[model samples]
Target chain A: MSTGGHKGATAAGRLSVLVGALSVPAFVGLWELIARSRIVNAVLFPPPSTVAVAVLDWIQSGQFFGDLSASLFRVTVGFLIGTAGGIMLGVLTGRFRLVSSLLSPLFHILRPIPPIAFVPIVILWFGLSETGKLFLVVWGVFFTVWLATHIGVQKVDRGLVRAALMLGTPRRQMLSEIILLGALPYIVVGLRTAVSISFYTLVAAELAGAFAGIVYRIEIAQQNMQTGQVMGGLAALGLLSFVADRSFAAIAERAVWWR
Target chain B: MVAMMHNPLRPTPPLRLVDAPPEPSSTAPEAIIRVENLSIVFDVPRGEVIAVDRVSLAVMPGEFVSLVGPSGCGKSTLLNAMAGLERPFEGEVIVAGKPMLAPRPDIGMVFQQPHLFPWKSVRRNIAHGPRALGKSKTEALRIADDLIEMIGLTKFASAYPHTLSGGMQQRVAIARALANQPRELLMDEPFGALDAQTRAVMQDNLLELRDRINATIVFVTHDIDEAILLSDRVLIMSAGPGRILRDLSVGLPRPRSSAILTDPAYLALKRDCLDLIRTEGRKAFEQMEAVT
Candidate 1:
């Protein structure tokens, strides 16, 4: 009886795997049929074939590479700068009450205000340049990483700190090694959240004003009423952010090496 | 030290044991740790609570002393004072003729939990102490390798703390403490978290380790048998504004093992300790009852 149940369970598992594999293809096929059938206006909601053709044409066009690199550069450089600043400040505020008292209140107020809300002020401050776009992405990523590291540092095991103190761990080593490494798990978690936030803010940044980017191309395509190109741009953005999040997750797993 | 009297309300056991001996006076070598009238107070929400009340004791160089008491008796608090991890509300703890205001490299401590660095391997964890004290990487790692071998964890030297068993992790903690070659080792129930079998093995390991290291050791535990088994002197403490009740000396010969747990002399000493602790435990219980 148990063997029969086990066999049935394996069969169900295999069926679920097959179903999952077909899920996206099935949805696309249905959307294609519905669009061609005129259930929806094809111009507004282009069929999968049209979108695929537009994406292929985009790759063939020399402008695609420029757009892709521009978007990638802003995200990568902005993420790195924001992450660095966040971790440095997080360690300071987390370790020192004086530093925390001076900065935490200000950060709390600024953190809740959406980064996109700063678009008008950022343009005024830095104009419609790369700096403003970078600032928006950095603003979005910084608070998340900072809060995670701050909480992580505070939550470090008291027992470990006491043990380190007993071992005569010098003050500097205590902060760099024990305190920092102890809080790394939390920091990594914050960093992962920041990855997605960086992409979200990129949308706002590129929408505000950009010479070249995936979102910029989408806006240009919308102006020309090229629905297929617009849909293709959206897909590209989704795929990029999805890849970023997954790759970061893999990196994060290794970051907390002990775990 | 105050001696405990047998309870007249209950019939006495057949064991005929000598009363606790008087505290040893100052002799040739000066004490390595001298806790003078130390008291620690903690502020709770309602009011302040006295954890240790005017506790004074001295541990001689190379002496193995155990502070035995019930839970919340402040024996650990007193031990923390010696480690400079706790501040005295009044008086002070002097180690090596200097008041202990902060933890010094020359003094080491092992806590109930292993508290090993989860990110570091056994070797790196042990090396942390030496490296923190400004030793070069090579010298620190060499010290770590030696201590790892001493702790019989050479096979698992590169294993992280979370990967090891509780007993193995604690062995690494001990090695880490010894990495600095501290003049004084303070252990707050180092084996209390282990199972009975593991704890027994650790006690034997500690006994063997003690003979080789020349450091003065101060151990804290609530287990009477454990206290008597490992210590040259066992100081019994009473709870409720914790105070020392008796100081008993174990005159058992060295090169001892779990085999001594059955010896007649050992049994007699154990009985006396149990009797005193049982009475004190009752008094503490009654006092708590009255408070509520």
Candidate 2:
């Protein structure tokens, strides 16, 4: 009797797995059928087949690579520069009273203002230039990484510091090794959050004005009323960001290596 | 290895005991660690509270001393003052004839928790002190290897602290402190966190380790057996506003082991310590009642 019940449960589990695997494909198949059935406007609500064709066309146009590289460059370079500045300043402000007193209030005040809100000022400063877009992304990523690093440094175990002091660790090595590694777990958490923030700010940046970028192409496709291309662009953006986040998570897991 | 077979993770065997050091003559005039009327104060919201109250003691070189007291008796604060980890509100702490304003490389301390760097392996953790003192990587690792062999953790030298048991981690911590080869070692209840069985083993291990090293040691613990078994002299301290109540010399024979616990002379010394602590504890209790 128990074996019968166990077999029944296993069958149910396998069925659920099968259904889950078909979920996305089933949704696409239904959409394709409905679009061809002429129940709704196919031009505006393009089917999966139309979307796929549009994506293929985009790849063939050679502009896809340009747009992808532009977008990738902005996010990577901006994230790197912003994260570096944030961690450096975070260590300074987090570790030293004088630096914290001088910068913390200003950072706290600015951090709450959304990166999107900087669009107008960014436009005024560097009209239609790549610098303006890069500025927006860096601005979005900087505060988050800075705040994380700052809090991480502050929350480092006081016992570890005391032990290091008793061990006669020099002031420089204390900060670079003991304090940095002690607070690394927290910093990695902050960096992961900034990865998403970088993408969020990228939207505002390209939409603000850009010659080439995935979001810029989305805006252009929208203007031309090519809904299939616009949907294709959206799909590409989602996949790119998802990959970035997952890869970052893997790196973070290794970052705290001891764990 | 034979005794530890019950636990597969514990590959360490009982270490071979080293010959005990020749007893230092009591008449040695110069003290290695001197606390002259030292007092340490902490500020609570209510007001200032004294932790160490005008305590004075002198430890001659190569002596093994224990500070015995109940919990919160400021024994650790007193030890910290000697280590230069705490500031004195009055009087002075002098080590090796130099006034201790800051922690010097010549003095080492082991806290209750191992506080090993989680990222570093046991070898690296032990090497940290020497590395911090500006020793090269190879030289530091050489020192760590020797200490690892001495502590009987050669199998787990590359293991991180988390992988090791409480006793093993504490052993690593001791080796780390000894890496710098300090002139004096201050330990604040180093084995207090271990289990009874592990604590016994650690106490025996420390006794053997002490026999080989020449550093003067000042250990703080609330365990009476631990104090009597380990110290050449035990200084008993009173509760709150901590003061040394009595100083009893442990006259047990050298090359001692847990076997000494049953000796009539050891029991007599322990009884005297218990009597002093019991009377002081009752007085402290009454004093609390009177204040309330």
Candidate 3:
């Protein structure tokens, strides 16, 4: 009786795995069929085949590489700069009451205003340049990383701090080692959230004005009424963000290496 | 033999005098730690609460002393004052003839929880103290390696704190505390979190370790048996708003082991400690009930 139950459970597990594998492909096949049929307007909601063709043409046109690199550069460089600034300021505010008193109130007020809302003012200040686009992404990423680091630093174990103190650890070493490492798990969590926020703000930035980017191409395609290219651009953006999040998740797992 | 004398199956004769007579006052000048009318208070929402109440004691150099009391009795608070982790509301703690206002490299402490650096391996965690004192990496690691071997954790030197068992992690904490070779070692219920079997084993390990280190030791615990087993002198503390009730010196022979637990002299000493604590515990309980 137990053997039969075990066999039944294994069969169910295998069936679930098979179903999960087919889930995305099945959805795509159904969408293709529905588009090919007269059920929806193919021009507006182009079939998967049309979208695939457009993506292939994009790659052949060689503009795709330029567009991809531009978008990648904005996200990567902006994320790095924002993360560095956030961590630095966060450590300062988190560790020192004087620093926190001076900055935390201002950050709290500015933090509530969405980075997307800054697009208009950013355009005024930097005027459709790469700097303007970079500002928006940095603005979006900074607050998340900062808040996470601030809270993380504050929540560091008092016991660890006491233990370090009793061991004769100096003030500087205490912050750099015990306090910083203790709060790292929280900082990594903040960094992961910032990854997605960087992409979201990239949309707002590129929409504001951009000479070249994935979102820029999508806007140009929309103007020309090339629905297939527009869909392709959306797909490319989704794939890029998905890859970024997954890779970061992998990196984050190792970031708290002790666990 | 000695093991036979400690056998539970046999009824051993009670020794007439288990307690040692008070030592001469001339030893005071050589005292490693001197707590003079020390008190600590905590401000709760309603009002301030006294944790330590004018507690005064002296521990001579190379002495192993235990502060034994019930939970919330502020025994740990008193020990913290000695470690410079707690400030006295009045009076002060003087170690090595100097007042302790901040933690110094000459003093080390092991808390109830190991508080080992989760990110660092056993070796690196032990090496932290030396490195923080500006020792070179090579010298610090060498110190760490020697201490790891002493703690019998050489096999797991590179393993992180979370990967080790609770007992193993605590052993590493002891090694880390010893890394700086402090003149004094303060342990606040270091084995309080371990299970009975592990606690017993750790007690034995500490007994063996004590003979080898030259530092004066101040330990804290609520367990009467633990206090008597490891300490040269056990200072029994009264419940809340803690004050020392009795200072009992254990004269039981060392090279002590768990076997001494059943010895007649040891049992007599433990009984006296238990009776005093029981009376104090009852009094504290009644006082709380009256207030409520």
Candidate 4:
């Protein structure tokens, strides 16, 4: 009876895999049919083919690489700086009661304010320069990583700390080796979440006003009513964010090497 | 005959005292670790609670002492105080004539759990103590390798803590503690979490290991059998507001094994310990009932 049940379960699993493989293509085909059938105006609701052509033209124009690089640079640089700062402060506040007492309340007040809400003040301070865009992304990424690392450090096992203490571990080595590694699992989780957050804030940053970026191009295309280009830009942004999240997950799995 | 003592089925020999009873105050110059009028208090939600109250004891160098008590009797607290992990509410803990305010390299400890660094392999975990004490990487690794071999974990030297069984991990913890060559080693129920069979094996392993190292050891456990099986002296403690109730000299023969568990003299000592603990348990229970 168990063997029969196992065979049935295997068959269902294979069927699900087959269906999952066809899911995206089936949706795209149905949408293409609807757009071409005149059920929706093709000019406004362009099919995949129209969006593909628009993307091809975008590449041909040579502006695609420029926009891609600008967006990628902001996300990458902002993420690195924010993550570094977050981890440093998190360790301090988490380990020392005095530091936490001084900083935690202030950070708590500032953290909940969305990155998008900072656009008007950031524009006033830095104008339409790249600094403002970087600021927005960094602002979004920093709080998440900081909060995660802070809680992670605090949650480090007391028994491990005691064991390390009795072994004559110096203060610096205790923090760097035992406490830091103990918190790495939490830090990795925070960093992966920040990957998607960086992209989200990138949209807000570019839309605030950028000379070159995917979001900027999308905004320009929207103003011109080039719906196909706008749709293509959205697809590109979604694909980029998806890839970033997946790659980060892969890196995160290896960061805690022991697990 | 001397060979007859090794016979498992033979009638056990009389208890052989290792020495005369230690003086009441134990003010000898050779005492390595000393706790004088130590009190540890905790501020719980209800009110202040005394974990340990005016507990004074001295351990001679190279002595194997075990603090045995019921749970919450503060035996582990006393051990931690000696390790410098706990600040005394009053009085002081002195090691080698120096007061213990913070952990020093001369002292090492093994907690109940393995408490191994999950990120490091068995060799690296053992190497951590030496490395932290400012030893060179090569020197530290050499020390770790020697300890790994000593603990019979040479095969698992490269294995991570999570990959090893509980007993194996704990063996590494002990080796790690010993890696520093501490003058004194403090163990708080190091084998408490293991299974019956595993705990027995660990006890035997510890007995064998003890003969090879010369460090003074102070072990804490609630298990009376474990205390008697391992120590030269057993200090029994009372429950909450913990106080040392009795000091026993285990005058059993040396190079001992689990076979001593069946010895008649050993049973007599165990009976006395059980009676003291049971009387104390009942008094504590009655006191709680009165308060409620």
TM-score of 3: 0.92
- How close to the true structure is residue A49 of candidate 2, measured as C-alpha lDDT? 91
> Candidate 4, what DockQ?
0.65
Best-fitting candidate, scored by DockQ: 1
Q: Which ten residues in a row have the lowest lDDT in candidate 3 chain B?
A: B1-10
lDDT of 3 by residue, A1-259 (tens): 1325587877888888899999989988999999999699999999899999999999999989999999999999999999989988888899999999999999999998999999999999999999999999999899999999999999999999998998888998888888888889999999999999999999999999798999999999999999999999999999999999999999999999999
Q: Rate residue A246 of model 3 by lDDT.
A: 100
* Native contact fraction per model: 0.98, 0.69, 0.93, 0.90
- Point out the worst 10-residue segment of candidate 4 chain A by lDDT: A1-10
Segments in model 2 whose C-alpha atoms lie over 4 Å from true places? A1-13, B1-28, B286-292
Candidate 4 or 3, higher TM-score: 4
Q: Scoring each candidate complex against the real one, what DockQ results?
A: 0.71, 0.65, 0.63, 0.65
Q: What is the TM-score of each candidate against the true structure?
A: 0.93, 0.92, 0.92, 0.94
Task: Give the per-residue lDDT of model 1 (tens digit) for A163-210.
Answer: 999998989888889999999999999999999999999999999888
Interface root mean square deviation of every model, in Å?
Answer: 0.6, 1.0, 0.8, 0.8
Q: A209-230 in candidate 2: lDDT tens per residue?
A: 8999999999999999999999
Q: Rank the candidates by DockQ, best first.
A: 1, 2, 4, 3
Candidate 3 lDDT over residue span B72-99, tens digit each: 8999999998998888888778898788
Find the 10 residues in a row with the least total lDDT in model 4 chain B. Answer: B1-10
